[model samples]
Target: MHKRMAMLAFIILVVAWGIPSAKAACSTPVVNASFGSVTSFAVNSTASTSSGSLSVNCGSSLATIFNTDTISVRLTASTFASGTQAIMKKVGDSSGDNIPITVCLSVQNCGSPMTIGAPATTFNSTQLSIFLLTGGKNFTIPLFFSTQPGQTVAAGTYTTTLSFLTNWDICTGLGVGIGGIQICVIDQNGSATLSLTVTLEVTNDCTTILAPAVNFGTAPLLSSFSSVVQTISVTCTKGSVYTVGLNDGIHAVNGVRNMASGSNLIRYDIYQSTTNNRWGSSIASQRWSSTNATSVSTNQLIRNYNYTATLLSGQTTPVEGNYSDTITVDLSF
Candidate 1:
């Protein structure tokens, strides 16, 4: 009686090994499409980028009975998406400040991306794998992203959320008779939504500076030389406080700026205000400041600094030749 009971139990275990398991389910996504701390000028000058992956996993159900599974992720705009492209806006800002962006699978050129709320585009090609090896076909879709250029936005964090759809085919190998192995046990429509949080950061800074050329044109004598005024235009991040400094000219002697003509020096000075004080490269020398006490509210706030270059009266007249000197301009924040 004991031998018969052991044989019956062994037969039951063999039958259970051949039976199919339950259907497969994928893991929920936690993704972020983040471009950390990008300057406003960087986003405007070129594409700012961030990336995250979308993954798929089917259950391990008897590799002997299954060949390999194929998968294709389709990127479609979600329910909350409105435009034909993804747009990020400043968090908690209701003034409608937005930055348009795009996502791509290939890094060659993000030229063509799927529309935000239109037909679906395949995120990746058919992912092929052997069912027995590499359990659940461990794979991750390579997502590339870029923000559209030419945006002059305020300094802060910008954010948006995008949606996607994924489709997969879980196949089974049934027979080794006709054409080797046959495909069977298709999925009963597998799909999932991915909410991709896109974020960007803009820091307060001075972006651009347009220095002026002070042309003290053609003065035959020292006393006849007139003061020349020129403007320095500066573009900075909105609300950022900054200062501009000008170094003494390349040709100088005893703290006095000089224009050199073949070692013949002519004295001159550059002042922030008309005869107030010479503009030198130091905070103590009183660099031009962007703000007094209030924030600059405009985007790419351009401030103009007018300076006067006067030929000093004490210097004797030099020979008849062209004299020029170069001064270095710097920005501090």
Candidate 2:
């Protein structure tokens, strides 16, 4: 009877120990790992304005150690494992309490509190994906901004840094242990800027006054007249040249338009040559010159032979006729 009792006690003790061992075997192993390398991460400015997502793969090394669907890692906003999670954050510099940007993180392949397991052992074969949580989709969550009104940011390289921590709960027969993974979140910002240029051109206004036609009625015989000055006034571009017309019958006497007249009715000055009225000789003349309006060293009329005169008394005669002359002026740079 005593031997049987001792045997029974022994069996009970073995079963108690076995129960705990069985529970330990079923629990998942703990794993804390990094991205394996401090590789570069990229963010596109032109990409969706909302926060983006990425995958931090647990290559073969981390896969084999914790090899179970229950084994997993999670990201937190806090710098340390125990700190509060980093929910949505601004990715850039901010004038207020936080930086000027907003950043959010998520599991690309699974939701938060997710589990990871591998079907293969190769480094490339193992994978995990993280994405923005609620507002991560193209137009779901909005990207906050406090941009200066009426002003656009210049194009350049803008970099933002984010600190992250990943942790896992590893189960052992005795208790649970915590492990941590360190990660860096970097955002590369890009943009395009534009500049505008305007050009204007100006021109000059051309103006001129031509010689006036003169008429003389019948006058005293042997009439004569003093010379008339032809003037040209430049109203626009300075130092420009103008051309004037002249002929043998009408000549320019030192920039003057002079015409000789006869005083008698039969000896009257005729604008045009006539053989019968030769008792007195008749003559006509015109002149021309040019100058810049602004720096007119000598003031001159733009009109060719702007003014003229005729005699109509004794020693002067009136010439009857619609006397007229043509003048041409051209401007050239």
Candidate 3:
């Protein structure tokens, strides 16, 4: 009965010995990628750039008990970005032409293109599940590129600086308690930043050249062969100030273009106009300057060259066989 006469209770407070959060830093957080030496058509098509990493260095006590940590990477637009897309400006361009681009965690499988300005990009859950190792732990988050193609801008070097925010959480436990309970012993929560200097060198290119066969049609007399007044479609890079010319054909004696049949030849010439402005290989003065640039489904600026190919008058008509000549379509930009 004397056992109920006394009761003892003890409480202990360890303020100075409390468990503190771990330290976090991005020792090598640089994401560098390049499409390199691509054509303007490449900017209007689907392609992937080389990969880089969001390298992180961790120093914490989580490796002892929980042996794990976590992190999340989110995109945010910087000074060089506008809206949800990144604009790469062409170097030395007076027009300030911009090529819009995007980045992703995957290649062409970019279901969620990073809307960095909106800060609405999805975080990589699998990559965030970090397992802290002994001594030190290094976490690498790979970054890939997925551009928003169909941009018909100037051809040159396009570049921009892209940055992203990284968040990390270090925990002291494995986040699972005994009896299947949800345990959360977060030791640290920190954030950092990283950048990607992307370069896209766009060379001038001729994407499409639809030159139909120059058929003078069968003619009994050389002077009776009707001139060809068809259209030659030339699609080149947008903003490419260029000149289009026709090189001397395979059978060019002197300055006259001749279609050959065995030893026989049919003299002819291609002119920019029906009134005798010969479209020769000399682009310095005799070039057909670029006209208005129009876009097609391929996002290329297509220019139409209307030229007339006429059989030289007063020339002897060749033999009754098919006389053909190959002419090179030339461009000087």
Candidate 4:
């Protein structure tokens, strides 16, 4: 009976000694990640993305102890200055213009709603587990960005810094604070940083649609002067300053514009407004200037201008048939 009791005590000691008594120590690893600049952002850009890589070395010792690990990555929200999502804009610009941006591990990463700068906005693989093998692991995450169509913003090179945070846990079945196994928490001790740059260009553009011809049809010769109204439609980029001018008609002499029928010419003048102020070559006084300041969520803005043309009272009508002249419309922005 004494020998049996001693053998049982020895067996208990062996079993207790076989189990680990301390938590495994892991060396902090350096994460090597980088991405290039994205240059496709425009005023009409819908969405754009830049591809990058994330890789880290866990070392053989740490991988052996923690065979499997679950990892999630978070980005610092303060880096983005606009909205709930990440944004970019011209460096050193005082203007409050910005372009909305976001980051994702895959299409699945974008599915989860995340607020900028919050740790809850993390990216991880839901379908698969990340294992810390002998060699380590690498991942691919893309930065997604977008701008509204016809968005009016300052044009320049925009830059921002992206800081990464990583959280990890061991896949061991053992509970924390039991049997010498402690809670697993992997902090971003040596995460990598990427300097992201985006560029935008603002261009001035305009489209002009001319109205139908002003027909002073069948006016009685040597009768009272005839008058007609004409119009032009101009669409331009928002916030663009522009000027509109009407050149001398094809038949002109010493600034006396005329409509001709064969060899006979009838004098006429174009007024800028109903007030009868002449529309001429000078941009300061005789031309029309306006600002495309109408705020629109989408599409370019249109501005219309109307002018009146009148035949001079002193015109002596001679042989007449179909009388016409082409006046060129000029727009400068």
Candidate 5:
């Protein structure tokens, strides 16, 4: 009986020693945040908004204990040009300039001037919580950014790298970084950068609206020196210098421009002023040149040039028919 009792006690001790501990080993949470390329922000834009998504992945160990975990992301302020959080030209630029822009996690939270690299306090502000499932959880975070009104920058493809930091809770009812909480930074993805690139594109643009054709209506074949005044309207970037040139008509001989009717030709000439100086196709002999300064609005600048065309008097009288000519107008900036 004594031997049996001793064996039973040994068996109980072995069974107790083989049992696993109640406290399970915790695995570090895995996190990955990503966003697509933002849409181009236009220069001189009053207001614009762009959106993207962030993805977060949690490990099985962390998911087993907690059904939900909190995460906080912070955007580090840009260091380009006076520490402004703006985009800069990536190539072919001598001046290292930045385009001013405003970024936010949501439209309502914009323009608050929150410090970069600072920790987000509340989920409504910049922090969000993810709900874990049986195996694990994949969370999607939405991001939004807006640009300041009346912002103008240089013309180029601007780019900037935005840095983000993520912090999450490891255990149930435990706040972030409280009582051995875990934090996974953007660079924790093993050589995979956790960053989003913000891009803005600025282009120098101009639009030209030509006036209706000048009609020297229904004149007799013997009519001498018929003339008409025509105008050309142009709108270009503010402070942009541009020139307008009118090419010689289809019927021309050795730079002498003319108009035509079927096989018949009528000699004519285009002049920049009433003084009758001929307007040529070359830039040096352009009909009009000016620096655009007339701002019709914040986004538009307008300029007008007047030209006169005359029918030469020495042409022999020809058969009466509809006469017309097409001239190619060239605008150079």
Candidate 6:
């Protein structure tokens, strides 16, 4: 009978041990887009014309060399969209200093890889022909080159480039815009334009921190005690040390008191001194430092310190009155 009972208990324990446990849920997010490999569409012309009731009044010298005049490309990625898409357009010859040029772009339904080119007289290719210089918004885009005040484009080549990433799926498309350029001299015109046939991916999500200011209250001290305790409290970042000291605020508490001294007596007996009197002339008088107090920190309600007061031997027992002193507290990071 005993052996049968033991076997039954063992069977119950085995069944309990075989029971399955519940699983915990995970919190990872699903990200499914790449925006790092996109490039800006190409700018065909050196000067772009705005559609928004704007005009360009190039002098006779610039007008004559409109085709061969030195032009540069520039780009700015300020336009942000919802979801995960961002556009950054770069123009060729972006470093041409002091000279202004116009730029334009067009978007089309690309089949696979994307391609952009100069304005065509007629629609011959499968891609749509977007006229950047013909018309549209009156916004003016400016491009320039760095040069000595009066020196012109010193008979050389110049260019600029721009690129952007799609916030959603990696789609080959052109960012629309009417580019402009700036100029200080007009000698020989040599320009550079960018090609928008390549694709790139991009990323733009990040994190940051925030901090608040510290506020303080008026501090008070005991007026009669030379060795008084000043309390201070502050809030700060975790695992960081905050140091506070006196001398930063006004001192209000001051004064001193006399202490009596005595010794032990017979068995189970306690002898004390209760004698009271004015400042005496033997030994020393109760004295204290007039300036520069001390500071300390701990996990307690109050901190105490011993200060030497001008002690007068003839002075009798300390007067039976409340004595206090005041000090300042300074807080720092």
Best by lDDT: 1
* Model 2 ranges with Cα > 4 A deviation: 1-196, 203-211, 214-218, 238-323, 329-333
Model 6 C-alpha lDDT per residue in residues 172-200, reported as the tens digit of each score: 11111112332222222222222222112
Clashes of 1: 0
Worst 10 residues of 3 by lDDT: 7-16
TM-score ranking of the models:
3, 1, 4, 5, 2, 6
TM-score for all models, in order of appearance: 0.65, 0.23, 0.68, 0.58, 0.52, 0.18
The residue pairs found clashing in candidate 1 are none
Cα lDDT, model 3, residue 15:
19
Q: Model 1, range 87-147, lDDT digits (tens) per residue?
A: 8887678766578877775342567776764455443223343212365434456577788
lDDT of 3 by residue, 183-252 (tens): 4444455777778777788888887788898887876877777889877788888767788878888999
lDDT of 6 at 226: 31
Q: How many angstroms is residue 37 displaced in model 3 relative to the true structure, after the best TM-score fit?
A: 2.8
Q: Which should have the higher TM-score, number 2 or number 3?
A: 3
Model 2, 281-307: lDDT tens digits are: 122122233431222433222222232
Scored against the true structure, residue 201 in model 4 reaches a CA lDDT of 48
Error of 3 at 79 (Å): 4.4
Q: Work out how many backbone clashes candidate 4 has.
A: 1
- Using alpha carbons, what is the TM-score of model 1? 0.65
lDDT of each: 0.67, 0.26, 0.66, 0.54, 0.54, 0.22
**Prediction RMSDs, each to the true structure:** 7.1, 26.3, 6.5, 8.5, 9.4, 33.1
Q: Of the candidates shown, which would achieve the greatest TM-score relative to the real structure?
A: 3
Q: On a 0 to 100 scale, what is the lDDT of residue 15 in model 4?
A: 47
Q: lDDT for model 2, please.
A: 0.26
lDDT of 5 at 270: 81
